[model samples]
Target: MQRDKFLKEIENLNHPNETLVPTHCSYCAMQCGMNLRVNTSTNKIIGVEPRYDWPVTLGKMCPKGVTAYQQTNHEDRLLKPLIRDDASLKGTKEGFREATWDEAYDLIVKRFKELQQNYGKDSLSVYGGVSMTNEKCYLTGKFARVALQTRYIDYNGRFCMASAAGGINRSLGVDRGSTLPWTDIHETDCLFLAGSNTAECHPTSMFRIWAVQERGGYLIIADPRETPIARRADVHLDLRPGTDLALANGILHLLIENGHVDEEFVKNHTNGFEETKQVVKEFTPEYTSQITGVAPEKIIRAAELYGKAPNAIVLFARGIEQQVKGVDNVSAYINMALVTGNIGRPKAGVGTITGQGNGQGGREHGQKADALPGYRKIANPQHVKEIAEVWGIKPEEMPEAGVSAYEMFGLMEQKTIRSLYLLCSNPVVSAPNSNYVRKMLKQLDFMVCVDFFLSESAEYADVVLPTTTWAEDEGTTTNVEGRVIKINRAQKPLGESKPDWQIQVELAERLGRGKYFSHLKTSKDIFDELRRASKGGNADYYGVTWEKIEKQNGVFWPCKSEDDPGTPHMFLDKKFYHPDGKAKIFALPYTPPAEEPDEEYPLRLTTGRVVYHYLSGNQTRRIQFLKDMSPEPFVEVHPDTAQKYNISHEEKVRLFTRRGEVIYKVKITEAIRKDTVFVPYHWDFERAANILTNPALDPISRMPEFKACAAEIEKIEVKKVQ
Candidate 1:
């Protein structure tokens, strides 16, 4: 097999002595490929060169990807371990002292052992991040159960992908974000994007959407705010916040009533269409208009466009998923796909616009609270047995799933889970009702955070260990299209930092669970184990190998063997993953947001991300260019709403909700709805939008409602110069 063509072309840019390393971005699920311009003399990564030949992104780097390498040399990069003093640990005053690696490790192991001995194994917990490589995520889950013998483990992916995952699994047989490759967008007649600011959040991915639009394909955007994507939409339905269910139901009703559905395909390939007909019958355009704030005519037009299109794909993201009825919101979208017979085919299906870097694969592995590797359910006895056998442990030795990420923190408040091992995630700023989450974290008996930067979440940890970022690590990351691509190490670990998997392996050895972890000598070793563990599971990787990745661009999952080329698009045979090989449809009804506007709280608050920063501003905040682009968090207020509150452009406004309150500088614009205010949730404690967000969870998915809450804005009084 020949080497990748991009590698050879990049040789000219790098010095004769220096190396150019290939790796996927650690930002969004798009996973744009880039090569680190390394200086062999200094052993430093000076810059990033786009890897144009990568299959998913085609070398297009978002703002986040271009500046992501700067974090390695960030001034605030955590270079040493810090052990909080007794006073700081007790919340008396802020204090932490630098300590040797051995000292920090001994303290962590000792405290963990004491907690394990006194409060039982379930008392220890771990919280992972989706940004981590597949190897690190797998090892994190393994360490939590095998090393500590604890059933309390979860990850930040719960908050990001739980709703999408649950919806996809229930409606279809499986839950890979995209049923078709990104290139399929060009072949579609239309692209229905709801609840996703595709142009800003996934800048590189927008090229695919643009390709469709350029070819006379229609664009339908449904969102509360007029994002960049919405401005250019063929039909932009500026729906009210948290009303995705109603809008989707209305669309389904219109499609079915207009006879735009493929009746023959529905009868042959799907079940539950009759039930959906009955449920959507009541969601007429007139009724749904009252709830969703979209005009009756606009809703009908959107339905007509999406329904009439011969080939189209519907995509949604956090705006739809981060709500109290997130699962139903997703179900509603899928229902439309079913009646329209848009699934299990080329250029037609439901896809989730996953936000996190590995949002799709991150949830597939056992890092989640209620899953084993390969996207297998923890409740399934056969799945438990299979994974247990692969792990070299008795099925009985394995415990049931623990509480989710949010539930784990709540357990801490109840004095149940006393120890928390947080790696690669910063829940203090990312979690809904974060003010309370911070308090719950402080109540933990022991807390250890592993990260290269001293993030807001790590500031409260009892011990903080500097861990290497993606630039200094070698592993595999699954992209939005379900392609697993190998990421090579570009530079050595800076200072005393270590890769996250190495830290977990070393910590496990210290915990006396060394024998089971001995086989994991490298990221590849762990990857091979993941392949064996996932052989017959949902996200089968047994067919993929590192050597194979070098030969091909990247391999998609369900690859049966080394000779297999791997499937870029799934369900081409029109067969679902269900027992009867048929897709299931939901007859979901509309439900209003958990918290709606009222006399006391007359404005709806919606939170999202800006183009420049990633989640929680953990790494992006350190990048000078990104920080310069977006200096601080600001609220987007409609001119009508701002006028009522007596707030002007760039003036500070106090936005209050039932959960909490904060004062953010307001940017008055007509881009937002008069009934709602929008804020980016990337700031710290003083201005974090999550502080005022509700923690109401979707019963099925357990995802928090971060998008909609009863909120009111008031102008902040200016102080005199005196």
Candidate 2:
């Protein structure tokens, strides 16, 4: 029965397999839809044209989206599977050699079986990425437990949105980004951005940002650097690194003292209001100014602007999330929004600026340490029974939740997990304390990586299997607003690469677990079962169908049945999903970063992204145009700090942290605070920012503090040319 179902679905598959296939960009969470101009005769991606009718961006796209098609035909794309060359026979002593798909699959199954028998099932681990489609993520987690039967599994979204998820789950009873539709941003009367430089990171979202200004709304930006987006704000509170929680407390304190809080909403729809009010009483603007580097007047001014606005939003990104106090930082922002009665309405709430392609959908459909498909809990017996039934397995067949992303690597150092399987991520470059992470990778008994290119992390693997790219596959990804949209295939797979789903299914077939996975053929086939698995869960998609997504631009989730219209705005009835139908207002206190500045390491080093590249620069850096725009790594130093260190603009300098140091060319600017230095975290190998970042994680979120670490600078004397 299962084999027949798989064959039928594969025979009736739908995706980017032909000319003019409609798909979305695979870069950011925006997921702007575009049509691939393909030449079916030669099965080549010719060009890209905007799908202007889609409401998300109105057909507008960033530079990356326009040039994304070039990657399909790029010369450097992997044409075949590559197995690590043995010491006896090889062109390069320690590199890979071309191999057939069968050879790659044989190596994977043989090594994994040997390791599982010797070190036990727990020795094999799986680490996935947020860029994968919802079906792929769910299948990866299931494959790990059902096929490998290992308890270790997680994804890269842990580094992107785990803190926000933790904060929202505890306070609001749910964790979907921007509970309202994407159009709500246009209706907001005031918007505050913390740690996010949206103008550069998500350029397509500018339509909503400008809409607020066009309607005379106020904008406030809080960051150590005055980025291009901050320049547009009415008030820019350039706070010191690791001071986000302090600044949020100060804003709320001012709002409460000025009688700006919505007392009615506090009394009826929330818990812990009195406690939060008591805590913010001591966070005056002056005290906040001493902690954060912002002036007292600016804090008060920004608070007043937001407090007076009828509709407001509090937006944050990795700047606030990638920290030791990440959850506390996010809870503070949510506290302010709830206190002002800014959410549960048209355009007032908290929204996370997701960084990865399917970060939203990835987290919603399992792949996290403690989560199951449809955001179900691993410990919840009812959720387990329902999902187990869908997969034709018993409730006990599912494994328990494992450690988080960073903790998984820590286990590798202990040799607990001997085999490693990575999908769609380059953790060797992106994980905190990457030098330590690489050492952990070297400790693995066997490693396999599935990706379109030989990424930095993949370069260390025993077997590298090629997978289909965005231009040649079809799947559905939920955008930042929780809208599920379909991406159609534009052309046939290049060379011998297959879709990620096919790879997992075939691997399962080879491992003697074919019965459970035989039904998953096409993405839609997997989605059909996913709908049944997700039924009655928070991220329910029972009513959504491939037919609906193709007919409409996209549909929002929690659409319970076919007759039910999609939910565009969450909590429209002003009731949260908490047990008592009321949201909780947390009274989180301000705390300093795990590592602080001292006399020896006198400056704070913070890392971030650039307009020309995305995370770790595995894909964007390969593109010639993007590389040309932002070539090489440089540190942004304040003019005053440069003088103190005897450094000049465009001169060689060394930034030293307790962990390590890297040489970078200095670019002096007044836009940054004198005590803080900003370095883009895109480049890898010798130029990666994670090389100097602290791995101290949030107790609740387990997110590393990549935003703030203590460091100092020294001028590297450059010799003149003869």
Candidate 3:
């Protein structure tokens, strides 16, 4: 019987030599290189492997990349367009009535025209998201600015990486796609990992950090919580949240006072040295240590490690830029890098680790409110004229820069924004202050959402356009190191779903703005134009053609010609693009957090991601394997604090803030600080963390304070309802 069963199993096997297709991960933007293999006969993806030959992890990937196959052909994916016949029905649909692609596009065109004709074009707002491909991002910007002529346009980047974009542009005259590549960090002798947890967020890259440690390289981490990476660091400076500016300025003070300053490098490579030095003198270690809650000795040590190291790489993330004073924090770090003569050299960099999969690409391609492709400010007359001339339109025809995400959501509630178009994002669950964002979406006259699944945001849409997932799409994405990787589709659409760029093109043509999309009949056409537009910019890809990039796996920007190998590290010669031909070191002061512990809310609250779940739980939670790894939400509280509150591990507790409260299971551990609690912002059950997140946005970048807030905890009675 066993031999007969084995023979039957062998007979069932077919097409064993299926070829694999090359592609990029569609999850978060680390863009870990990958390949997906499909059975030739069944056309079914059978396995996945890392792009080991490629740079940046040498093709290694985290758990997210290994399990990306689960997303393709998943049963929960949206295969058809869904229209809400009744707003009050929720998912209780009156009917799902499948329609042709033309029907869906025509319906959207009709509704959009009605909105424009009834309300002014400015009354309609389009929200681009980070999950989109480069082709979709470019087309979305073109459609909104040309076809719709809407002044209200922004994306979820405001919630995460807007400040990084603003600060980088202000300092370097352009936005993302780093001049520096990932290999630069490996060349450094010292790694100043501040306000970031790469061990947890980007585990594959952590191996590189381990390699750095093996080489006797120093590691210094600055964060409020002693994260896993921090515990392993040579020195961990637990600075108060939102006080990074003070810590950075104090380090600058120590470097100058100890004569560790690279005078030759500074004089030859930087500007504003005298004024910046004078301003930083006041931020002495003793003075800033008090405000930042770090010891003076530790502050001095951090400065020594950074200043004395032959090469130091300064890195930050949402923890630093997702605060009310985010821009100031970034400005201070930039000054520190420039003063130490740390930037523009191999392994000596000051850069932000972007959060979303395409946050870097999205901002670079002009999805930002104030930007056009290539980081050209929309408000700049010369830039506007240049883009307009390229698009064959009048410069004055373009609308002024508009409100950001927070302001746009507020306007929706105020009826100022009548129509809302959200692309590939779930703002209902992802936005800070969930209740208010949900209510505002409900109040909007019409809401249109484009996504691969029926997410929280799609639930409220009047019309939901099913979008193609990464396995069923084609385009390009820039990784954290600014390497542009291609994403070739491996599967066809499930039903009538289409790629986002195609939808945008069809809609534009239907709106009688076919001329706007006339130059681009395909995504490759747009990619070529993007290279042309970005010719002289910071992320120059003009030299990288399709044939060369595919053959090479990927290439970093500044590959201006087909014959040129892409640049891996930026600013190696200290040649800055500033008018003075030198990087400017700004003098900035630190401020307190937007929210803090008070009488009512007597503890500090911080939010972050977990190993198993991605932001908003849009896709990760749906995976049965991943869900089993971390099935429910929980709050990490120190045992001492939990005992004082009479809370126990696995016991239910209610976490409250001024805005809202959520009940979650408790995990009492000594790994956390005494007065602070850590909650992963993954679950969206009754206790979504974003529900209690403060909406205090940065005045300059308009990014919400997602890192730190004030809150209280209480034991909740787990009552069972019959």
Candidate 4:
């Protein structure tokens, strides 16, 4: 009866004048299923309705997903290409003038040729983002290496998913965000989430988390802040910022001492356990408490709960992965799942809370500086030969690997890279040390940006090309579970805006690289090429046709042939991805942050996302509803810290670091640590938390320590009127 009533209510939601087009949301990796309501006569996106048939999210939608359709016809949408003639107004919105596509293309081609001719091919760089479809990301790599012949190409994922990717690949020999399907989450006996704020970041997955606890399963959380999920956890290991490595090592030590080790499994299917065991031997609960600031009793409870469960899953996000030893932290947590024999089966494994819409697939295809299609390494001769054959070029024609995303700014400052082609990202607001990043961006000789709106970063562009929104394009994206899903077109392109794929193809034609890209006339054409390019590689997508995706709801990767079903649960036969078919257990030592708290800067400052905004607040902040909900950023201060600084709630305070400073309204609460302060990094300019963030990169992942830095807060004195 309940099922029938739910079906009836869903049927009642249909409108007579609107057509419901099935698609996915444009925000985070949850990729919540939604049906866009399109006006029948006008063919414009009107609103959105829940897609109850999709299995991953069911009918669930977060606030961002609910209002995603509003972005299609937003008033701030860029309707034409812009050209900035006045160099003095580079960082402001006052210098751009409307221009034709031909004018923009001519200017971009001329400038690009002059730079390459004078300063060599490596002078050009392409900085991209993962929010785009897999097709665009794949093409972006080919365009930079084959069309422009430049080696400096990197994406925004370096700052977001690189640490998780680095750790998972090193241990398991393959990088899939999740080892098990999302449907198995609720059936697990225990969930140990580290450094992730799931309630705000990936809210659609909360139902499954809550269902686990409701079924008498345990939930443990590790974070500096007492987040909403932490408040309800069986054990909240409120560790200090940048100390996740110590906390994870302590739990692993306890798990092993308590006889939770699966001796038979480790002896047969794993290597390096003895070495790892020796490294964590000194990380006792008492020793860990001294470093992480969490009680030893809480650490014991967390280990016991996880070790006693019959089936368990370990999950994490940027909080732990944004530190100087982020890769080490990830591997330490993965050690827990491996030691407990909780993986390679249903209701058990490890997963990452992917932050972007296509974070999984975007990294797989090629946007990273060192990668190729199918996660192939550019330095490998065999990998280069395979991709060269696919692109109809010689293996030697492929350029060597370049630096990471943040390092590209250093190259720009040194005049090594004089031009840039940026898309789908707003680095001026997102990158650490915003003041320095802005200065480097200004130093570039020429820059072109492709986006739907004039983002804070786009204001400095010489040419800004208008691009269509997700509702106006058709492509595929890999969700958080490593499931390959389709994004359908709900409406036609608005105004003169085009899709990023179309823009790139057209630009390639103008740059005399027509033969390589002109063959791809549509998104499906690009996908066909992508399938062939990814053949026989790690992230094989050869068998995942659009028809197959529609039939299977969504397909997991490594589907090699048309008859082959996708891999839903990885390592099902207890066979790992290493050459010897065995997973690795790494022995990583705990390392503190590059910039620890000092006497002068006595507080630890951490930054993260809020429930009301997405990365950089480029699109979400433009929406009326979301903007009203979170108009600006604020600093979260503990009561004791506020009292120590003589600050009060809602009062403005200046938060500073060695890099820069920003004044934010104080929000006093007991949810945060007394020695730490928290700020959201969604706003831009003076309010951006990146202004105070440290740019110390992890040696392995190249991920900056955006979560922890030395900071100090001061109360601003008010002046009395004379």
lDDT of 2 by residue, 220-263 (tens): 99989999989888999999999999999999999999999899
Query: Tens-digit lDDT track for model 4 on 1-722?
Result: 74786575466467576788999999899999999988888888877889999998899999899889989999999999999999788888989999999999999999999999999999999999999999999999999998899999999999899999999998888999999999999999999999999999999999999999999999999999999999999999999999999898899999889999999889888898999999999999999999999999999999999999999999999999998898988888888888888889999999999999999999998889999999999989999999999998899999999999999999999999999999999999999998999998887899999999999999989999999999999999999999999999999999999999999999999999889999999999999999999998899999999999999999999899999879999998989899998888888788888888999999999999988899999999999889989998999999999999999999999999999999999999999999999999999888999989999999888999999999999999999999
Best by lDDT: 4
Stretches of model 4 off by over 4 angstroms after superposition = 1-15
Q: Give the winner by lDDT: 2 or 3.
A: 2
TM-score for candidate 2, residues paired by index: 0.96
**lDDT of candidate 4 at residue 495, scale 0 to 100:** 97
How many Å off is the CA of 52 in candidate 4?
0.7
**Candidate No. with top TM-score:** 4
Q: Provide the global lDDT of candidate 4 against the true structure.
A: 0.93
lDDT of 2: 0.87
> Least accurate stretch of 10 residues (summed lDDT) in model 4?
6-15
Cα-based TM-score, every candidate? 0.97, 0.96, 0.94, 0.98
Q: lDDT scores for all predictions?
A: 0.87, 0.87, 0.79, 0.93
TM-score of 3: 0.94
TM-score of 4: 0.98
Instruction: Sort the predicted structures by lDDT, highest score first.
Output: 4, 2, 1, 3
C-alpha root-mean-square deviation, candidate 4: 3.1
Candidate 2 has its poorest 10 consecutive residues by lDDT at 85-94
